[model samples]
Target: MPPFDQTRFRLPRGARADAVLAGGVFVVVALGAEGQRLSHGEDSAPSQIASWLLIAAVCGTLLFRRRYPVTAGWFTVLGTGAYYLLSDIDGPLVIVPIVALYALAAQGRMQAAIGMAAAMIIGMAAITLAGSSDVTGTAVFMLTGWLVAVVALGSARHSRLAYAEEEARLRATEERLRIARELHDVIGHNISMINVQAGAALFRLKKDPAQAEEALGAIKASSKETLRELRATLGVLRRVDEQAPTAPAPGLARAAELVASAQLAGLPVRIERTGPERSLSAPVDLAAYRIVQESLTNAAKHSGAGQVTIRLAYGDRELALDIEDDGQGSAARPAGSGGGSGITGMTERARALGGELTAGPRPEGGFAVRARLPYGTTGKPMERSDR
Candidate 1:
């Protein structure tokens, strides 16, 4: 059995290929066996006209072989069995059975193909003993060997298709999660800051006009920046023919930008870092940036804190981050609560890199988030100017 048949007569791709090739095989067999065997004298002779018509009927079913493979396969097996029982001719009329069986299995009808295989083997064994004078088991063995090979090849094709489909599904799922995380980082943080600054701008408008103007300016800047990042986030899904932005991807190097936004939103912020500075792997860097972003977002939105401190401490084996806000100490909600994706996204990111994260209210006061991430292969020593 040929695993692939590239020797083509330019038959159109799908069902037409099966029909044309199978029809041609039937015609060739018919021409080669011009007449039936004159065995057991004229009394037992098979009619030439009847044999040709039976072969035509079986070959015609192959037209729908691809669309209704199981039905076509069964029809071919039954027709071939009838031909063996009735005809006194013996030639390569078995090619139609082989093609039908392959179609059924290659289309993932394993049970149907196996059933046809069993029927073919049984029919051949019975036909060997009844049609020929040779009582030896040689004919039965030979027929079984060839049919088994054809069935196996078709089954292998089915398995390969199944594996490919499963792989595609996994990639699609991963892409969806990646997009979700980007949205949570880009939209959530900026929206929170805008909400705060807009509220402050309105509250202080009459009492302190200059302070109100500053808050309004911060709101405008925050909104514009949000829109820019939103565009960058969505650019990932653009088609090949569409134009996409060429902005650098956000990571730990951009942490200071996040702090500046927080300050503009009327939340005083301080940063402390104690480390031999190094570069980080892309996934780890993005995760680090997102975790810090989401944490600051939560403080500005719900913490009710005036001051927030962000501490970054690096060691030989691990990197540690601590974000604390002197807020209402878990009075509002948990980090990822209120249908928010903040804590969920951060947790997934940390676990993916064999790291861990935790967030809760400190015993004395305020809310704190701590994350410890492995340096692993994702980090390397770099110059201070790299940032």
Candidate 2:
């Protein structure tokens, strides 16, 4: 039975819930008024009937409390005053107005709620001073406290709900950005290789059939990898209630594959490692791999480089990456600065892991992307201070 989805049977909210609450308050106030009338035996029948009608009207205002909080708040306050004036019994009818005040404050009407609460407190104090009815000064003081508490609780509820909504929005934005980066890294790199191999195949097809066949094979491999990675990336969005993906995310372990693919795409790549090799956290590893992949893609597509070098320096607390291509000095732009998000995405990834990435043309006649990624840290990355 699907575990009986408790949310499906939870208490109502909004208008329907207000209706329920109004009905419950009406019953309680009505019973209290009737008991007081019986105990006093001084109120006339007409007055008693008028008090019941007033109670009904005041409680009915709660039905629109959520939809029209301010209007209902004022109506309930005034209606309660009328109820007291018409009826000899001081019952629990004030509860309706208190609830209305809460609704007003919860709807972000702090000014109006505070105003109405002050008016009620002052009016009660005036009545106590005038010596009308049996209500005491202490009762008025208690009512002030109740009103203050209700407004405070309502405002707190509003702030909490606002914060939760903002948090949800931020999470959604982060997820979208993550998906976009993944798609670009997975599909963009493979597609660029496919395009280059297709061009090479067409250029050699007439004169060199064997070379063209090799290029076609490279194209086929690139396409197959593209589809596989694309499917895996999209599968994450489709799986909401299913088991998490068992496949490991692409990390530094796959750097050799990237190098091989770039080589097939006619870009020579050499990887130099320094310091002892060590495992890294998943996020840091993924970021490092993606930074390398994006740098290579940019080089293959934009940089007219005959050779590229990727250096990895492992340290006790940080990993440093340096990818430099000996391409045309003026033509080498890190991650194709011509309106693509490649470099931006890579920089965001590094920064999210408490790291820094810098990409620009090197003074020594090439383009370089240098990054310093912390091993594990709780601090956020400082703002991007270097291009």
Q: What shift in Å separates residue 302 of candidate 1 from its native position after superposition?
A: 1.6
Error of 1 at 66 (Å): 2.7
Tell how far residue 88 is off in model 1, in angstroms. 3.0
Residue 176 in candidate 1 has what lDDT? 92
Regions of candidate 2 where Cα sits further than 4 Å from its true position: 1-8, 240-248, 330-340, 377-387
Instruction: Give the total clashing residue pairs for model 1.
Output: 1
TM-score of each predicted structure versus truth: 0.86, 0.91
Model 1 over residues 223-306: C-alpha lDDT tens digits? Answer: 988898877666567744545556567888888889988887888889888888778888878888899999999898888898
Q: Against the hidden true structure, what lDDT does model 1 obtain?
A: 0.81
**TM-score of the candidate numbered 2?**
0.91
Lowest-lDDT window of 10 residues in candidate 2?
378-387
**Could you give candidate 2's per-residue lDDT for residues 263-292 as a string of tens digits?**
877899999887767678889989999999
lDDT of 1 at 345: 83
